[model samples]
Target: MKVNNSNLDFDSNATDSESERAAVAPVVCLENIHKQFGSLEVLKGIDLKASAGEVISLIGSSGSGKSTLLRCANLLEVPQDGEIIFEGEPIIWSGSGFSRKPSDNDQVRKLRTNLSMVFQQFNLWAHLTILENVIEAPVTVLGRDPLQSAAFGLELLEKVGIGDKSDAYPSQLSGGQQQRAAIARALAMEPRAILFDEPTSALDPELEAEVVRVIKSLADEGRTMIIVTHDMKLAREVANQSIFLHQGLIEEQGDPEELFGNPKSERLQQFLSATASV
Candidate 1:
């Protein structure tokens, strides 16, 4: 397939068009993306485009490959086929066939730094304080001074509303606090975009709101984000657009209000109705 390169350009000159036209150029573009594990295909010819600073939510039932697609966006899982363009550059897929040339380890690391991921598990280091957890990556992997990294880390913690918990270890913090700290860590990398995989799924309802508030603030700041979430309310409120995935394929996608309030596909209508009841 000849991939369309027009949607990948993000130059300032391209921004002079009408607001809607400017918004159409994607900051993140995925075309013919396919992922499989053994014989089970996870993502089948998925195509998605997200504009600069847009929040695109991926929503679906469990096992619908929403999380898998998010992972593939950041190269956490090597898709068997497809092209992913981030920040105007095609993500060099290291896997076999049709994808771009294999990226070396150094190149892969650099690409990952541009795309940070926040997981549901809140994967913080047990021994490190919240501050340390956020600064460790910049200091070690990025090779910045620890003191400089710590300063930025604190700012990120404050941004996520967890600056007060900076000195506390992960074990000492509540689940919500820990997840906020994890988000801060991702922000500390100064990524071009963030990928979230069910960020609030592990939290209780009360705790979930706290993390969602931080995400809302990020969206308000115009940070590009791709969130894989089952929380329909969050999707409806936070997302500028929503994509409905069903059985590893995109069932329907459009403006959040249109997709949620008036779904176009029978599969999406059924999925939403079933989920709304639960």
Candidate 2:
């Protein structure tokens, strides 16, 4: 749990020695994160760390604050209390309690670019082609050349097994295809880590398998990721670390194998049984 300051800044293009040192530090760290909507508390004093090439899965029942925790990681939803650190740099805040918000827009923007989020709903632009959806942010936000972005976008789409449907819009694709396109779009950012919020929940079992395969492939590639999912099978299969939340706090967490097969917490055992019956 000790974070090394020497590994604070990570550069993919760094020398081998630097990369080795950087691998020890977390790409993202959340400390004592607390969030509440009006009077309803969602997260309470949560702490999480994701190092390079680490896949962490958050599994719990609905209202356990899984989605809110993901949003807070990229500053999509600011926590009223706690620290959000990216590459060891703490986020600057402007106010206290309910009015608290990130103080610097530029810093938030920089961090967000490295933390790509894939929503459960596949929030793609219906008017744009699949390829366009993948390249838009890289071109507009990062100022990359449109031509090169399109080329890379196509490569990403191909990687996601949707090269033939690059010209199709979100409305024209099946839910599985659309989700794959969304995954490709997330890859287009070349993010340090990808955050998946129930990426497979929107699809039927057959369609869900498609996304699961892609996610498992990413894990095999050593991609740093945090997944919030209801599918215990996917969590057990792909995650290096698995965490179970109950009433806004981590009830139990550890290696996926032990967590799933020999869960010590009664709540997690109950949860696994219920999901199994579903």
Candidate 3:
């Protein structure tokens, strides 16, 4: 398989026939993206795309910029360089040389409502009931009708397999259950895509599968998703495509089967073999 830097843009219209091929329009496109924290450069010229309904898993060791890249996708972390187009609209860039003014609080809030994010720690409001936590943002932030938001929240909880936990508080639920509720909350907003950052990294093996199952179900239903994870097995099973980052740069990426089963990059091969050895 020949993996080159030429096809790194995330536009769905872009095409390349190297290893494995699939037909779909990319929902998320990143072109020449770069991020830095003072002197520390995290993401270096990242070009990637995800087709509608395609599941792309980001894998790399700690500090490889996987999480930073995911955050930039949803504008959670602003990039110093490059363009990010989500579902078609360019994410407002704040830094110099960008035409659009950086997104303000209100603009960013709206962007977030459309593109939901699920964190690893399951950032739920402990004081609120499961249902309330899910409905809070939609009603308070989006000004959605209370009744309609509640109904939607309930439906989402059920969809994520935790409808019965609506009345319980976060403290009352297990790690897996809490994560599921978080996912439901993200879904309630009806975002064009969901960004997951290490959703299952904190869970034990047994508990992890519950979250994985829900994610798999979402993929089956054709939900566009980008996940930053260390779980190679789950990535292999659920991801249609994969990206491997090394030292803050994309080392290799392609179909998960090709990347995992037969990686071409020396960095990727070394990383996989090391992971397997562990």
Candidate 4:
């Protein structure tokens, strides 16, 4: 398959006939978002959106708020200001500032149902086996059928190249296997949009490539995803839209080819230069 991110048109998979066409909306949208950690402002009046089947990548230096933005998008870190909308519905909130959160906890939970996040550290449950980890959320949070979920979970494990280790505990597997298991867990949710926060950061070169391969396959399948990563080459290969954040704000963003090929912002140029070998 030919992948060209020259214009961030991550819609190659949207090639449906007119008869199959339907009204489409962004899978997720963040509007004028702001976040702070006791006076350390992170995200500052930021707006981001990912449409169905689109792949987006966020890249920058450390503390540029790339991870923070991903956290805020999924409500892992509640933004003090701004709107988080999932599939066009704004998350219900009332209080202001640090106190801001979903007015109804249930609403927030429901919203999370449509968004899946893959963390930097493979946050797998040490107590559970690989298959169990994948099905736990669907069976518990979503109340899906455990028996059916198990069968499907096995399929996902196989897809990620760890099917044979379905019964193995995370602590028993290699770091690469564990991260792939985490990805299987996220896929089990079958979320509309998947948020990846440095999915391969914790792995060695070989292990990291394994996870990156899995991620690239997902992108080819038209899964909508927003990824925060330092892997510039992988970002360019897999993402259509690319964003560069600097000092709590977006410094530059556009098609990955344009942004990575000919960076316009001085900060982005410096950051890219710094990580060129990687």
Candidate 5:
């Protein structure tokens, strides 16, 4: 499978009007995902799929489990009863419910390496310079050469419009710059897809626009990403498919235009109305 080559003559802003990866084999699949916290059920039988280069947006209210589902996809959060299929291969499971985890720890690590995450909080190491933060994972986990990773890190930073800030520490930059640097770090791994947990939630409107521009650029390049976002406009513009989750269950899902234009569920109708006001 020929994905967006991170090393080629990659133009972050270049739009690919060719066919989307909707027909490409799924890079990540969440089957019957169920999660709970003591007595509270966060996700119930949630199913999702992201094909190569396809961007899917997860939308819901504060407690609707969108973030939790995204975390489960990357196994940052464990789902008691669900199957995570990465590149079509299911992770080995050992137990049921709360005790559930991948039987093979090594496999879990390898699977996670491909499903990189960009958090609501930039989560950059405050002590490390932007370039160091970006190259850490590639050099440490992937065993990529530091020199090569540094070069790629600089390219990714430039792609996110923060190349000059590579030597700057997180605290020295604005919130938007930090988030863009975080995005550059996620891109450093050259993963199959990215799981964005509300990439713009932490920023003000002005700062949010900076990150959104980079996200739109990535979408145009056919980079597979599953984004958990509250920005309805962003969902409409960047996501090919939008999923509306209601109290841990998928209430509605389809093309963003169709789902937003003509919502089928009363719950979704109310949610849309509420978010529209925000």
Candidate 6:
């Protein structure tokens, strides 16, 4: 039904309802975040929040630190400064600045499991079948029963529209298929939120549409997601809060319609203008 549709349609009054839901508490919150690699600063004094069922899109040019911000939220890359709070718990940290890291291994692991990341590249195991790839982490890391995990993994694969390919190796699938498999893997975690880093960038236009369709279905189901994307249209369509990042800082942010249609910052306006032509 809804999942099979190519076009995404949202209720006209969803904004009001979503706002009410978001007022409870953010699932993930970042305050005054700062990240740097060597001497090159990536994210500078950034603040972000993702409440349950709210979709946030990070959009900017290359080197704008959108992906870096996502990584910090997922703890794939620890920020040199800032508080990373998940579901009301602040990440325990040790040291300061460049030397800072998460102090509690258990906390990091717990948070990581609750925030699943789907990367730009498929990142699937070539040797494992699609179903195995989907169930591997759940069965091993989460200690789920193998038979039950396999059944749920198959359901997730079907949800992503690749049930027929469950026994296929990643090498046998197209870029879009592999990415869908990755999405299934992320879903298998039953995470509180999903972090997407340029999820459609690796596929060609036709194949990209396939992945986009699945993402739209997820958005329709009100999945909490933070997406770093170059696809302006997808950002506008799926994101409730659209943030425009420039040179490692937030240039502007607001409702996607207002931010995209009536950008306040000149930088954001210019960025939209440039991306519109591509």
Per TM-score, the best of the predicted structures is 4
Across 6-47, the per-residue lDDT of candidate 5 in tens digits comes to 211112223363234333447898989999999999999988
Query: Model 2 over residues 23-140: C-alpha lDDT tens digits?
Result: 5657899999999999999999998888787788999999999899999999999899999999889999999899999999999998999999999999998899999999999999
Q: Provide the overall lDDT of each model, using Cα atoms, as 2-decimal numbers.
A: 0.82, 0.89, 0.82, 0.87, 0.87, 0.89
lDDT of 1: 0.82
Model 4 lDDT tens row, 1-278: 22334334323334443113226557788989999999899888888878777789999899999999999888989999999988878899988998887787787887787788898889999999999999999999999999999999999999999999999999999999999999999999989989999988888999999999999999989888999998897788898799999999989988888899999989988889889855
Per-candidate TM vs. native?
0.88, 0.92, 0.87, 0.93, 0.91, 0.92
Poorly placed runs, candidate 4 (over 4 Å): 1-22
Worst 10 residues of 5 by lDDT: 5-14
- List clashing residue pairs in candidate 2: none
Better of 3 and 5 by TM-score: 5
| Better-scoring candidate (TM-score), 2 or 3 | 2
Q: What are the runs in model 5 whose C-alpha is more than 4 Å off? A: 1-24
**Residues 44-151, candidate 6, lDDT per residue (tens digit)?**
999997877778889999999999999999899999999999988999999998889999999999999999999999899878999999999999999999999999
Instruction: List candidate 3 segments past 4 Å from native.
Output: 1-25, 94-101, 104-107
Report lDDT (Cα) of residue 77, candidate 3. 74
Judged by whole-model lDDT over C-alpha atoms, candidate 4 comes out at 0.87
What does the lDDT come to for candidate 5? 0.87
- Cα error, candidate 4, residue 70 (Å): 0.5
| Each candidate structure's count of clashing pairs | 0, 0, 5, 0, 0, 0
Q: Per-residue CA lDDT of candidate 3, range 191-248, in tens?
A: 8778899999989888899999999998888777889998999888888778999988
**Which structure is stronger by TM-score: 1 or 2?**
2
Candidate 1 off by > 4 Å: 1-25, 93-101
Backbone clash tally for model 4? 0
